[model samples]
Target: MLPEKTDTVVVGGGQAGLAMSEHLGNCGIPHVVLERARVAERWRSERWDSLVANGPAWHDRFPSMAFADTAPDAFATKHSVASYFEDFARQIDAPVHCGTEVRKVRRVEGGTGFRVETSKGTIEAQNIVAATGPFQKPVIPPVLPELAGLTQMHSSAYRNPDQLAPGAVLVVGAGSSGTQIASELQRAGRRVYLSVGPHDRPPRSYRGRDFCWWLGVLGKWESKTPPVGKAHVTIAVSGANGGETVDFRRLAAAGITLVGRTQGYDNGVLRFNADLVANIAAGDANYLSLLQEADDYALREGLDLPAESAAHVIPSDPGCLTDPILSLDLAEAGITTVIWATGFAQDFSWLQVDTFGPDGKPQHDCGVATAPGVYFIGLPWLSMRGSAFIWGVWVDARHVAQHIAARHSQATG
Candidate 1:
């Protein structure tokens, strides 16, 4: 039997939701977490079989649970990450209601609460926390129209090179997914062409320490710098294999052909921008800027950070800097598969409130939605750049939980 109302209701059962529920429980506030599928469904099914957390297991730990028996620097596979969340929820005794899909969330007309309609039942609560992670919907551009014979799949659906058609594969977007997938395919003996895009290619490590460690040391992860209210920068660094940097130079050295950003398809020919070199240069410059910031911070703190080896920096190779292939005839290139590693967009269609900005993203000051009592957790830059990652979500989660608890107390008193 479901309750008619509750003090607070968390809208998802993932790490963010569970984290918020933990805090709510600590405050002696009642709450329930609703999930459309089993906990961490995206980790279980959406990612590739061999995919692991972009950061190390140690950094991926949440406030609810420390990663026990796991190597701190080792990458946690998708299954392991999902299992960790499941275990965390269980150990914390989070009130999670799995298989309960939220169909709609509307303000209780003229009231100080919300009505969350679900597939199972309606949940009335004084507060609602939308803990849906940042990547809500995979963005396959409108220009990615289906070709008659060639196969197409988004990176979210890609498993491995074995699942692809046995021929050349064209990976669009040079972010982490694009670079990583292209590397995997090329190594699997498939000719892979990677399309370079506007991306930041920070090295996986710098100064003999993991780049993330430096960021944490410099207080970048927990920096209270407010978001500029613009689209957040796309960060695409990787920490695979105990922190090996994956960039254009590394991919080219591994036998992957690089191309410019994909423009569109016209008359069965794919078009690309003639800016591959410029894009790569820009990415390298951004990496250098971040490295300089880290160096400055270390200097101010009197830390003796090791200097980076120029030879190990993986600079752009002449062979990889060929003239851009402006237009590619797919058949002539022998490309049989195209994987769009583009990105994702938030989907708040189920949210019946009107506090969203022009970008369709909810406007929140640190996790509290503009519509009072409606909060969001695990959103990109919710508190800082790190807020989107598992290692950083607890910052926003705790704040939201306490905000709700305070509101509940005021109502009761």
Candidate 2:
């Protein structure tokens, strides 16, 4: 049964929600976290078996608990990440209602607070903190609505190469997920075809230190300046296989066929626009911009940083750059599996608040939601670029909890 009322109701048990709960408890605030599944369920079920965190273990710590026993250089696997969150919830004694899925969060009668309807029961709260995470839903394009007699799945549903049938595979969207999946398939001796797009290609490690270290030292991680809407695409950083870079060039070298960006389907044939070279060049430009910013910061701060490394440009390959592939017959190429690595879409269908903007994102000055008594955490560029990451959730979570506490004081005072 639900409590009569709580000071705050956190609607997730992932990194963001757990961190928020920790801070609320620290302040002696009465709150509860409602989770649809066990803590870190996405890491346990949605992710692939061999998937690893994009950053190192050192960067994945919660404020109350650090992975002191684990090596800082180690990249946490899917299982390890899930275990870490479970242990965190237990160690902190987090009040999480697992297996309780929230169906709707509408304002209570008279606008006093919120009524959170869940599978178990209805919960009333003076404030709500939506920490449902950024990756809400997997996005599949409209082109392949029905692929006859072919197996198609999003990267979130994909497990391993052995699950696919014996045939060539086409992986769409050359972001981190697409590239990584394609690389894995090629390594397993499967013919892989990767569609390219405009993406950031930053090196995993640079100049004897991880790229994240430089970001921290250069004040990139702490900056609260949010990007102008979703137009800004984040670089797909990877710490897979001991911090190796995963880009189109790397995949191409590993014998993965590189094609242009997928446009649409035309009469049972896959269509690709001729923008491969342009997309690759744009990615290289973004990589250079990041390096340049870091170099300028080092110089301005009089830091003893190493000289900038030479750029790793994609070699001119006729098959990838010059030759244009307008269309392809799936049956002719013997392509049996198509993996959609096209990223995720957010769904706030249960939230009955009017604080969202035209982009369907919560319009808030930092974590404070436009709707009074409601807050948010784990949003990209919410307080900073790192706000959505593991360690980065601490600041936003603490801020939201403090906001709730101050409001409670005013209400009771």
Candidate 3:
């Protein structure tokens, strides 16, 4: 039962959409939240079974609601996170229409409003909030040539080691997801080859404080988006195994084969970039930088904190750095599965508006798009470094909702 008209329509039912709905309700703006599946569908279905929140439970939740059952320092599992969002939606009384897929959104002819077509029915709205979040579509690079017998899948589709083909696994991309998956596969007795990439390596905790806590205290979450030409790299830290630093050297020492970035597949063999050593060194530098920042902050504030020893600070070079694998034959090494943990791409094809840039990304100032009445939320660095997280989504949602309210008042007044 879709409404014939509404003041606004939120095009997602994940954390972002639910947050937007909460703020809209607070402002007394009538809106409907449309979700393709159940609320927080990605967390419910897309994530790997072993996945946990990278941030601790306390910091990862909405400000108004706490993970009452979860320990403050403990990381909530993916199932818990999904349930948390669903519970929050219920608590806020968000009008989320699950199983309602938004097929297309286009400007209504000769009108200031827009028309949203969904699987259930059509809805006319004055504003549209694209809360589709960051991870919309999985991105698998075309570097590897397709083999007839090879099993391939993205990290999003991966569940557990048992789900993969019983053979050696090649996990491409050294981000948190890739590393975690590769480590899990190796520990599960599969020979794992992890493709190294440029990434920031932050310790899960420092001086009895979680990395997220450090970020909050240091005001790093308030950091703005990178300047033009600079890229934002996600930190490779994990809350698995009761929280631990994501050190490649340690992973390699534990028996995972380390390799350079995947280049392309040559005649029946896969080639990789000869930059494994450089990538390792860069990750080490980022790790050290964080340690240094934390140490300096403690000293400046005269806070008593445990100091890391010099020997502990420097990690021994792994064998992979000295003897990097540049190429490999899948058949020769008995590799059967290739997991692409590369990343995801934005899919706004249904959004028929001129709000996208040359890179196919939404062109917006914060959440407000270039196109009138079109807005975006749940994007990384949308407002700050925290924009993609739970608390940040609420902040940005409130801002967007306020803007919409102002616009509505101006139009109706």
Highest-lDDT candidate: 3
On lDDT, the stronger of 1 and 3 is 3
Better of 2 and 3 by TM-score: 3
Q: In angstroms, give how far residue 392 of model 3 lies from its true place.
A: 1.1
Off by over 4 Å in 2: 223-234, 298-318
Runs in model 1 lying further than 4 Å from the true structure: 223-232, 311-316
By lDDT, rank the candidates, best first: 3, 2, 1
Lowest summed lDDT across 10 adjacent residues in model 2 is found at: 226-235
lDDT (Cα, tens digit) per residue for candidate 1, span 148-222: 478988999999878987889999888777777888888889898999876776667787777778778867688
- Which lDDT values do the candidates have, in the order given? 0.81, 0.84, 0.89
Instruction: Compute the lDDT for candidate 1.
Output: 0.81
Over the stretch 110-158, how does candidate 3's per-residue lDDT look in tens digits?
9879999999989999999999999998998877666437888999999
CA RMSD per model (angstroms): 2.0, 2.0, 1.3
- The TM-score, computed over Cα atoms with residue i paired to residue i, of candidate 1 is 0.94
Model 3 misplacement above 4 A = 227-232, 310-312
Residue pairs in collision within model 3 = none
TM-score of each: 0.94, 0.94, 0.97
* Residue 93 shift from truth in candidate 2, angstroms: 1.0
Minimum summed lDDT over a 10-residue window in model 1 is located at 226-235
